[model samples]
Target: MVNQAEQIDVPCADAIMRLLERYGFDTIFSIPGVHTVDFYRTFPERGFRHVTPRHEQGAAFMAYGYAFATGRPACCMLITGPGLLNAGTGIAEAYSDSLPMLVLTASNQRAELGVGRGCLHETKSQHAVEQQIAGFSHLVLDTANVAEVLHRSISLFLTARPRPAIIEIPRDLLAAPTRVTLETASMFHPPAPAPEAAKMAADLVAGATRAIAILGGGCRRSADAVLELIERLGIIAVTTNAGKGVVPEDHPLSLGSSLPFEPVRTLLEEADVVLAIGTELGETDLLYTCKPYQIPGKLIRIDIDPHQLTMNFHPSLAILSDAGLAAKEICKHLSASVSGADRADREKIVRDSRAKLVGEWSAEAPKHKAILDVLAGSLDRDALICADSTQLAYTGNHYYPSKTAGAWLFPNGYGTLGSAMPAAIGAKIGCPSRQVVAIVGDGSFLYTLEELATAVENRVGIPIVLWNNRSYGEIKDAMNAGGIPTIGVDLYTPDFVAVARGFGCQAILVESLSQFGAELGKALSRDVPTLLQIDADGPSFAELAN
Candidate 1:
């Protein structure tokens, strides 16, 4: 069948912009360069908010965070070659978590595309690089296919698997007169499990002496459905970092996040049956070395990707299905059988495990609870927490409980540092009505410090919480644990509050825990960007190694 096409007498850039806006994307994160200037020029005419991050990589990460935060697909654009390569890391993170987004990158001139004559911004293959990092990648060489290609890219972004999609539109095409036929982007959902499979799984759960659900990133899309099923059945639940907040760590049935914590680890070890959903059960999330139970119990794995069924642990039941649909079906099959004194007894175990765990974690946390206490107390119920990858991030991951799913923008899959600031900026833009905050270590904060300017320019009012310890504390802890002397890990301290103020952000330094709550209150109340820097060691990195 021939793909859709139509002729429109306008620059390719103009057509692309209108098409994206029509497809429900009102905001974009981008960085412009010579090859991509044509598209950037159309931004004013398109009337969409274009957020320009300080770095191309940060732009891509911002886009990822936007989509992850709002449960909506987002878009990003960058210059060709070096710009595309810079976005590779962010694209990989989106791919790992199956975030829905579109990455539109400029390519060398269509005429000079493949010729090795050293054309400006040329690459070995821009499309090829993008293809490896996203769910789908297509090169639009013909101006006629501009709208069609972009629409299709959005469709791919929202559908099956729901990872990022890329469209590489060559620079020449942006100015070329083109045939443009706008098509509404379609959504293709992943297939649900067969009725028999759903029934079998439900029956197994109904009969289990002890059963628990292990949730992951993929389940975020179907959080409500999963939550309903678990709550209705009174089944205890636990989550990986990417899946944290699905059942609300505050919820009594939730064992909270699995890795880098003790309760979920001990509980998983003692379970007679495990029902894993929408996650690869990755090594880091597994906290494999932290525990001794490799295959804790009989497994029941459900995932959209068939390739992941047997990845880490083979399951007694592997159901190929959409997490939400399968969960709904299983709830139907086990409607009346999930309740009883026996189930209540098992649930008490989950509650007991959580209490024991929280009591322990909270004990140590109160010692350094200034940041934690202030954040927990001051956070808006609907706020989004975009956390960087560092010692403090891990502490927040374990200590800060999310009441809503998809509201926690964590750098889990790729574990990249410097993601918190830009991601928080994107989260704020994606859901302007909801508050967004960034929590980062000083080392990671500097990696994307330029974005403080991005936040200032865009008027994004995210409160950034900086843990200034003057060292890569996690790395230093690793050295100490490994019996090596810590060196080259210390960072030269800076006047962070002064720096933030210079960037037009409201800024303050918390010299002691006594000053913590009020400073955070000030930052959160500001309508413009703000920063709170605390000189501290968060949760003791060594505890996480356990």
Candidate 2:
């Protein structure tokens, strides 16, 4: 309980704490340093859980994973200068997927802020550099104004275009006694949809004879609405990498989440109307410069951010509104012009498209089945899985069927390596009831392996599955594709099993494909965290992409 007597003379940093609790943050992922140790010193007694990851980058990724696992904004506190810069990769990844986060940074005193006095943790343009990747970046120049700045920054985390927001506070203010006006945190209520845009979107999709609904990460908040619209309008649904499993893939009308794959491309080609929902049809999703995406039909899009409406393909009708509200409004106004006779044609289109894709997977069943079986056996249908950027991730993301929006956690937008382990640990902490797994490559796993210590110290058990390819497989494949010899890409990894055990996790090394499932089942069933290193020497993803 916060004491009124104590709050009467609360330091600005303590006032910030009161504001944080008011805004619904119970835990903060952070790494303490000289510049930010004062706040850490008083942190534990203030009823806040401080999770200290080994590295600043891991702490940032942990915050991202926590936010993804729980449908709330996560916070990461770091020292200024190097600490803030180290967190750039994770911040960039979260920005790409539009995840909500709060990054609290401690800067030099307000007087020496940009004077280049060579003060500890001093950097010029720290706020500017952070602003480039963050949704909003601001400085708290005064102790009295810290509460207001925190309130504003927290609110932006819940806005329609939710992403990470950075707020830098000067060290001098942290301990200074100040009277800051702190109000009860306002529940971040999103803006309502424009009535006219909703009506127009309803008219566009409700009347189409054959409509295809494409979902992206923006659709996460409206999974139910998307499902309802799909069932109501009898339209086909396909998800993007960022928006995977917004609608359960088990539905008959569902085409599994894969970007620009053959079956989904066919659906788009034949679609009389395409309802692009909550995703910016970015270059990667469209496989642009490889083969441009041309919509031959009426295109309608619903998105919270207006800028994305025409980021890539021009939409015939663009509705700037919350995805859930937009979907419900479209459903309400929709009465498909498609008749009972046209129903057969629509159903056939969905069945044939899904069947063709399944058939292709079946053709390559021998190669992928081992990995799929182990995943199926080890994790619950709704388990949360983190994917590092590597060749292995490309395949799992394309074929893996996630039942819920947050179940598949990939660095979809940033495509960064070394993200899966720390993010996986954060996901476990965020949702302790659910099983969490990190699927990573040997090359990528080495990047954040230090996080294993963080995981063990925190007693967060996340079973990690490493594709031990012993090389930067993607780069090697790219080199071979261009008819160039492999150079610096080939890697030499430490014994991962020994490394995992040394870090206090149950470790298993499986060489044969047949033993993969059994070993995984054992690891996942255990209460403690585990790591299973698989000897993978398959054809590169470049071959699979072909």
Clashing pairs in 2: none
lDDT for each residue of candidate 2 in 1-546, tens digit (9 for 90 to 100): 222332356887777777788777888998888777767656776687779898989998999999898978899999989999999999888888888889988888889977998998789878888888998888887777776677788777666688898988888878888785545466666655677777787776667776888898888877898888877777778888778889887677788675466777766777789998888887656421134456789998878888998878898887787788887776767655345656566677777876676533323334444575568655787898898876666666767778887788888777788989999888888888888888898999988999999988988877788877788876786798799999999888898889889989999876555566677767666656789776665434333222
Q: Please, what is the TM-score per model?
A: 0.91, 0.92
In the range 1-546, model 1's lDDT, one tens digit per residue, is: 234555357788888887888678888888878888888666787788888888888888889889888888888888889888987888888888788878888888877777878987789777878878888888987887776677677656554677888888888778888756654445556688888888888878777777788899889989999998887667789888888888998887887774545666666677778889998888667432245335467888888888889987889999888889989988878858456786678668876776676543423254334456567777776678888876666666766778788877777777788888888888888788887889888899888898888888887888888877789887787798899989999889788889889989998766555466677667776767888776664343333122
- What are the per-model numbers of colliding residue pairs? 3, 0
Highest TM-score model number: 2
Off by over 4 Å in 2: 1-9, 286-290, 335-344, 358-366, 512-514, 538-546
Global lDDT of model 1: 0.78
